[model samples]
Target: MITAVSELVKYYSSFVDAELLKAYLAGSRSEERDPMEHIEAGVQWICQAQDAFECGGVARSYSMIYQPYFRKSGWFAPYPETTGYIIPTLIDYARLVNSQELVDRALRMADWECRVQMPSGAVQGGMIDQASSPAIFNTGQVIFGWIRAFHETGEPAYLASAIKAGKFLVSQQDEDGAWRKSLSDFTMNSRMSSYTYNTRTAWGLMELARVTGDEEFEEAAIRNVEFALGQQLENGWFRSNCLNDPSQPLLHTIAYCIRGIMEIGALMKNQEYIARARRAADSVLARLRQDGSLAGRFNERWEPAVSWRCLTGEAQMAGIWGRLYQITGQPDYLKGLRRTNAALRKVQFLRTDQPGLYGGISGSEPIHGMYGRFEILNWAVKFFLDAQMLELSLMKKSDIRLQSNGLGDVASAN
Candidate 1:
């Protein structure tokens, strides 16, 4: 009740200030509006975001949201966590179109992350300035980029960095496979001390295990995944998961858990694990509004906890659905994937005069909502690009305009 009251107080207080009120009104209009007509424009926005950060050389993240009040001369600062994982997207896009531009960009990002890595093989949480402390989660994400870089260019440095990070993860693991120390702010709240979404770290470890043929890494990854699996309720709810709040978990964290479980399941060929992931995913799919937007937060019962949608979560879920459909041959999953992707596409502001808003996905439909209020998040654009790319791989186009039957047959044909 206290949390609820505090949130309500925060919400109502937004109207008291003129700047906040103006921002909220503009966001409200953006939310109710239709999606842009072209997926190309959103793709352009994603490229712009990448370029926006590339000016700094390592192609890190933008430190500030490009807004009137928040505008600054130089905004590029490499966010180690997102930049680490963003390598795969850049590499994938580069390979798809044979674009050396993207390949060079990916190489620069990988090199930057490797250069900034802590001696202990960990990356810091938050932005470079704020995340001065070593964090296991951030390190795991960086390992992801490093591993991909190794595959793309066979760079010894990338592999070496990934090995260091993977070893660090193994060294930090508890007997029960849970990471008890070096946590990010996402899981350091007083209300919770651990998060199930660290399954993402486990997922990264699994990748390392595959490449290095290290049984220890595989065992550690599986141990952590087992820990996450134990948190799954019968109704498919995952406990102690969220970026900030545990009581009301964000769909973004939930998708992270689901995707991690699904990937590891595929790797280990564990049908039960795959089934469990699908069950949790189905619960989320059940809550999708007819318009394809999902509330950012959900309760244990899979009920909406917030009216605003988390654009990042929506994109992540689309990728999850796309992967599920590819694996399980589920028609509903493909349908939901397309619908959700379309809804996200609709929300992309192709005609925006504001460069910050041009191709960037809003953190929430109304920019003033709780998550990334009045800002365009780098990860939002990253996941949005991911989903679009996944959709393109499933079907032959960026737009989800293919027939349901044709799309459903993708896995079978492959």
Candidate 2:
């Protein structure tokens, strides 16, 4: 009881920044702004994050609070895992805006990734300065950046790097397709051994297969995904899926799981994989609040595990829901997409004096929430841009009109 009180006191006492405190007190209320404006701000913030470190990779996050224990605050070191995925987002945005600068920035990031690749062809976990151990999930993520970079530049080096990373993943897998080794040290716990969320890693392998026409990579990806599907319950909840707690998985990891299955299903033309993904997506959709907020974590029975909102997860679900609508032509998925995106826009800081917070999405809705407490994460902004871009694309294609309130209604579109 004494320890709990002490911890709570420490948490509150850490709010030394008056400006950040004011922003926290304001909560995640929606503000009226243009989506493109938000996108541009987010892109600019990301560029700033990349420049924070001497390396060309994106910073892990920007800390809003000062911590004496870590003896450091502000933009963190370059993170290879997120920087790998951010490449595709930057490239997509660059094309949309016809900006060669963003394209060159993404290529520089890709080149840095290749230089840091471990001798075993795997990427390290955590920031560049952290322990240089090879991680399964991180390696899988870097493959995405390399693959996209290869397509963009037609550079043999990018494909070569991707192929090496894919081989390392295949070599580390057990006979049952689950990876019991090379887990990220940051997420390691004595109780958890296998992570079902590695399905995202499987998606990367499948992409390599498509590009290289290697049946070995495709077969390995299939085996791993099938293993993950076996862990799904009748209610669509996955066991052994969370980064730290499998009993109450974060919505961020949940979205990762669903997206991997959904994309792989579409690529392979498998109805079963698509159906499984739909079941999980529908379960999460049923839990969305009227204001478009979802609990940061959920239990196996589809119950909310926390009051705070995981904004990154919500942005990811927006994209997933949008894709589902595209696949099934379902109205509910479209409604979900609009509601979630609307909620995110409301919370995004447009006029903050802090460059780190401007147009950047917090890990949680409230600045001090548990997910990425007091920090603005780069991945959050990346997902937000992707979801908003998707929503705009679909609206344009279907001739949907945006309402005065910033959210468009499907009834009006028809």
Candidate 3:
């Protein structure tokens, strides 16, 4: 029978394997040819992910088929409205590349100041935006993205939207500091086998903490983490995952969840959250291999079915490993980082050289997400840059400094 959170390790192992980390440990899966190739490929992929989104901020998707046909593009381009997702991604890309165009795109999407605000004033757009009112989760995502853009570029356009979004989110929290289910529909569309609105709601709060230095955001984020912790299965796993995009639980979302908790742990200087992270890390590492590739999906029997690997599984895992290294100072995390990144390099799918053009991602892998396959490819650019720049930055900051100093000293002595 499944035991306590720690003992029910078998169920939780899927999260670890979600990123295909086995390949990292194997080490022979990918060649370390040109590092720039990976970076370039990542940039190309991100551009493609952006292209998938049509005008009016609609994702240009179909019915259950979920195929985002490029030929069907521009359908929504003329629409004056926008969605929540397109904005955050634009902001993230803006920060990573220091691109003004991305920042501009996000701001332009937010053109309607307070008019789009629901009674709660949160910014939201997604598949649901087409029908039901704005969702808290989607609003939070866009708000979080706009806040990042503000923090990165200091554009007031983004900040105005963020302030409304952040305050609205803070106000929406239940008395316990956690957000309730849905407010716009069915008092919050209560379909979750496990509570994720509160779990998923942490991003806007956490981002506010990072940008505003506000304790409320930090406190609110911890409350959601606490609520999510309460929802952990008997085997220490979370279910009732994303009903919106129901395929698999991504390591990135898991990482974000852990990060919210970790941030709270850091803010309060609490070790329990750190302990919690270590637990999750071990749970994930349990299924990881040296080659950096992880088993995509697992059966109820706890055996990994290799047929499930996808682009998202790797990028998200790479992020988690990097953060693990940050928290623990373990080189093993870096090895995981290198392996997963290499594997992603080998297969950067679903993107053309230039975005805003004819680009298509094959609608097969993870057939449930047919067109959205390239979504993860967009994330690879952001994470791959981290893998390269992490060590590169250190080398630049200290080693490069010392070498320059040494040369100056030698020249002076001569």
Candidate 4:
């Protein structure tokens, strides 16, 4: 009991700055603001994270408070797994905003990834400083960057890298479509055998299949997705899905699973896959509070398992909801998208003097929540920007559809 109190005191004492204290006390709930402003701030934070790392790849996170145990703070080393997927977001944002600098920066990130890739064609797990070892999930994620880079520049090098990574993924995959080997060291011990969330990795393989016209990649992706679907309960909660605890899975992994299924469904034009994804998405949507916040974790029964909010998962779900709106023209999904995005915008610190806190989404709301615990995560910002961009694009499309249907004034009001 004494140790717990001491730890709490230490945690609070780390917030030495008055500004940080003020921001913390302000909490994550606030009035709706412009998403584009938040998007811009998110992009700026990402750039700073990259610059701080001094490598083309973005840093893993920015510590907002001091950690007495680790005696560490500030920007962390570049993470290959997230950095791989972040490439596509950077490229999409650059094109949307017409920024050549960001485009070049993303290409450099891809090059850095290529430099550090293992001879086995698999990307290393954890940060760059970690011992070099092949990781199945990491390799699958980096394939995303190479695929996008190749499409953007018609670069043979990017294509070659993607093919190699895809081959590695295919080789590691089990006949049942599960990946039982070369899992990320960061995953919990209980989940080492297989992860349902690797459906996201399967999505990466599917993307490669689309680019290379390789039936092998497509078949492997299908097997993995099928394996993941088998883990989904009738209520849409997935078993053996969480990185830490399967009994109570983090919403971040939940969103990842749904997104993989959704994307693959769309790519393959399979309505069954889309419907299955919607089942899970809808279950999650039902858990949204009236204030638009959701619990960071949920149990197998789809009950809230924590008080804090996983901001990363919220942003991801917003994008998923937005996509569902586009696919089905569902009003509830549209409403959920707007509500969640607005909630996210409110929490974004647009006026902060601290560059680390400015524009970067915290891994969890309240900052000190267990998910990321006082860190602004790179992937959090990446997913936030992606969601905001999707919101903007979809709203514009919705407006056009409404206008063409003779609801011009209604569209104008929105």
Among all candidates shown, the one with the greatest lDDT: 2
Q: Estimate every model's Cα lDDT from 0 to 1.
A: 0.73, 0.84, 0.48, 0.83
List where candidate 4 sits over 4 angstroms from the true fold: 1-13, 27-31, 68-71, 399-414
What lDDT, from 0 to 1, does candidate 3 have?
0.48
lDDT score of residue 17 within candidate 4: 65
lDDT of 2 by residue, 342-389 (tens): 889888877566777777888987766889887889999888888887
Candidate 1 lDDT (Cα, 0 to 1): 0.73
Candidate 3 segments whose C-alpha is farther than 4 A from its true place? 1-33, 48-119, 176-178, 183-190, 197-200, 233-236, 242-253, 297-306, 350-414
Deviation in Å, model 4, residue 250 alpha carbon: 0.3
- Give TM-scores for every candidate, taking all chains together and pairing residue i with residue i: 0.84, 0.92, 0.66, 0.91
Q: Write the residue-wise lDDT of candidate 4 on 301-335 in tens digits.
A: 99999999999999889878877776677889888
Better of 2 and 4 by TM-score: 2
Winner by lDDT between candidate 3 and candidate 1: 1
lDDT by residue (244-306, candidate 1, tens digit) is 777789988999888888888877888988999998999999888898889999999888999
What does each candidate score in C-alpha RMSD?
Answer: 6.3, 5.3, 11.8, 4.9
Q: What C-alpha lDDT, on a 0 to 100 scale, does residue 109 get in candidate 3?
A: 52
Which one wins on TM-score? Answer: 2
lDDT of 3 by residue, 68-183 (tens): 23212222221111234345544544555678876666565555333455556654333323444545565665664566456556778667766667777777777565565344
- Candidate 4 lDDT score at position 195: 82
List candidate 1 stretches off by more than 4 Å. Answer: 1-47, 50-76, 185-187, 397-414
